[model samples]
Target: MNTHAMVMALALLISSAHLHAQDTVVIDGAVTDRHGKAVPLCDVIFNPSGFIADDSLYFKCDANGRYRAEIPAGHYNSLYSLDLPQYAKTQLEFWGWNLQLTENQTIDIAFDTIEVYSLAVWASNGGSQSLFAAFRPMHLAAAKLPRLYYKNVDGTPKAIMDISPTLTKSDIQASIDGEPVVLIDFHWSYEHAGQCSAGKDSPFSENEPCYMPMIIAQFHKPKLAPGKHLLRVRIQDHLSKEIGEGVTHFSSNSMGLGF
Candidate 1:
């Protein structure tokens, strides 16, 4: 081969080798609360910040909120699924630091805890329909609120609201006599000046204290008969903070509420 041709061929081979090395990077990360407590079962989602609309990469934290995912070596916006329906949307920002995934990188995500002010269950509208409940969360000021948007739903909006809290990343469950009961739906709202607005509607006025509303888990089966029933409620925040809890006597005729 001629000298000039040999030099060009060698340069091309080196460039190709570098490109191949760039494509083999992996990402390892751990999800934890701000206090260093592990956040288990949290979804770790990777969104490409580039023009290419690639499908988001999804992974989950283990029982200790640790996760590992192999990445294709690119810049991405890491998002953690930290469920905080009661705080202002801005205050609930769960995005991690921007990630530039190179060769076998490691990133750690830390989230703060959410506050649960109160929790209660009641029979609204004369109890003809299923049961309803309310959980009041601590509100965030406007400057720190997150943006709220709408998404499509499959069934009745009421049912969707009732079931949301049950599906939270935290372990939230209600059972009777060691038997599990189906939570039909989940709902949430925001409270300001004694008036509550649906969470989906955002941009609250900055004049008053606005709080994220609590999740109300509804029950349609294993009827809450008119007698003594032990009601237990527990809630943990992103940082493993037990922000809300309740253990009280419930009766069909009582306005069920315990802090």
Candidate 2:
């Protein structure tokens, strides 16, 4: 072969090897609940970021909630799973952000079933000095609630909000800056599914109507000295009588803040 052609061939081979190295990495892990119980039959979604392609990836777990996959090395926004029939979903917590996965690693995910996994408190309006807080009452689906079942257009049983659980103002006990505060408005926030696909054999449907639940409440900010303040929240399931609580510290300047 000519000298110029031989050099070109060697350069091509080196470029191919570099691309291959950047595209292959083994990730294996198990999804478990707060008590270390397997959260079976769910797909873990990895959302990519930055200059990488917008296509997301899914890792299907076995009935034992264990998964292993080969994915491209890149920066990712977060990894999370959708709600299962028997368990409430988890998101954005404990999952690393701006994650750079470049080598083989084990990443275990834990869902907060029957506990308060995370809490965030922030100032809603600076002028009004009103504060807002939200928390996940993990494993909320386990609570007893009356279900109104109906068939879908395809004759499949449609998922309905009738089975969705809720908490009243009486169910939450919150305190800010060591003083009692009333949770005036109580509501639920949901994260809908989009542009993600699950394995055909997986029990979780990407199009399922039900999703994870979050409890949000608002309280009037007390007149405190401008500094860091403590907010404590306790939540209870009216049906199961289970309780979950979390604490967070925020500053007086914590407008639109979250923890």
Model number with the top TM-score: 2
Candidate 1 Cα misplacement greater than 4 A, ranges: 1-21, 50-54, 81-93, 113-259
* Alpha carbon deviation, residue 17, candidate 2 (Å): 52
Q: After superposition, how far is residue 157 of candidate 2 from its true place, in Å?
A: 15
Q: Whose lDDT is greatest here?
A: 2
The ten-residue window of minimal lDDT in model 2 covers 89-98
Candidate 2 lDDT, tens digit per residue, 95-166? Answer: 323344676777665544345444667775535556787665653454343232333434555433332334
TM-score of each: 0.35, 0.42
Q: Relative to the unseen true structure, what is the C-alpha lDDT of residue 68 in candidate 2, on a scale of 0 to 100?
A: 84
Model 1 C-alpha lDDT per residue in residues 23-99, reported as the tens digit of each score: 86766666655456787777666666632246777777788777888768865544344534523453332443234
Query: Candidate 1 at residue 90, lDDT?
Result: 32
User: Where does model 2 exceed 4 Å of error?
Assistant: 1-113, 140-166, 192-210, 253-259
Whole-model Cα lDDT of every candidate shown, in order: 0.49, 0.59
